[model samples]
Target: MKLIIAVVQDRDSNRLSQALVWEHIPVTKLASTGGFLRAGNTTFLIGVDDDRVEKVLEIIRKNSQVRKGWMTPHMGGGNEGDGSYPVEVQVGGATVFVLSVERFEHF
Candidate 1:
């Protein structure tokens, strides 16, 4: 068996859940906090047979996305990357993990 761990943005948690359910994939969801950005996140725990690993990975890949931070020119024709140092807020993305499950049990 394999344990699939998907960490996704809180904004798209509901959508991801619905899609997984549509594929008949069972998941255990947990609300979590992002480490770098301190934003909310959703963690998904899914246990499936070994053969289904690829399918589960595909689902996560389709949903969890990497976002880019756009920088622009500031006053005095200085680029954002210039050492002028403008204070702006930005959030980091999500992470995912998968591991082999030796055993899983339920009451």
Candidate 2:
């Protein structure tokens, strides 16, 4: 067995979950926060046979898309220690991992 973990954007969570379910894949969703923007995110846990690894990855790949992130105003352009450094950044991206599941139990 393999455990598939997917970290995705909040907006894409529902769509990704639905797509996984449509493919008859069961998953667990957990709330998460992004590192850069501290934005809300979703982490999905999927358990499947090793043979389905590729398929699961495909679903995650389709759902986990990179989106533009908000940025603050730029500071310290000329002034030193002005306490403001802002610029546009891209933050919405995703990561997926597949690990061996030696044992799994549900209560």
Best by lDDT: 2
lDDT for each residue of candidate 1 in 1-107, tens digit (9 for 90 to 100): 99888888887688778888999999999999877664789999988889988987777777656555445336468555576644453433457777989988877
For model 2, residues 1-107, the per-residue Cα lDDT tens digits are: 99988888898899899999999999999999878664888999999998999998887777766756666565525567666656667655678888899998878
Model 1 misplacement above 4 A = 67-93
TM-score of 2: 0.72
RMSD, candidate 2, Å: 6.1
Q: Which ranges in model 2 have alpha carbons more than 4 Å from their true place?
A: 67-92
Weakest ten-residue segment in model 2 by summed lDDT = 69-78
Give the lowest summed-lDDT range of ten residues in model 1.
Answer: 85-94
TM-score of each: 0.71, 0.72
How well does candidate 1 score on lDDT at residue 21? 92
Predictions in order: lDDT? 0.77, 0.83
Error (Å) of candidate 1 at residue 107 is 4.1
Clashing pairs in 2: none
lDDT score, residue 72, model 1?
39
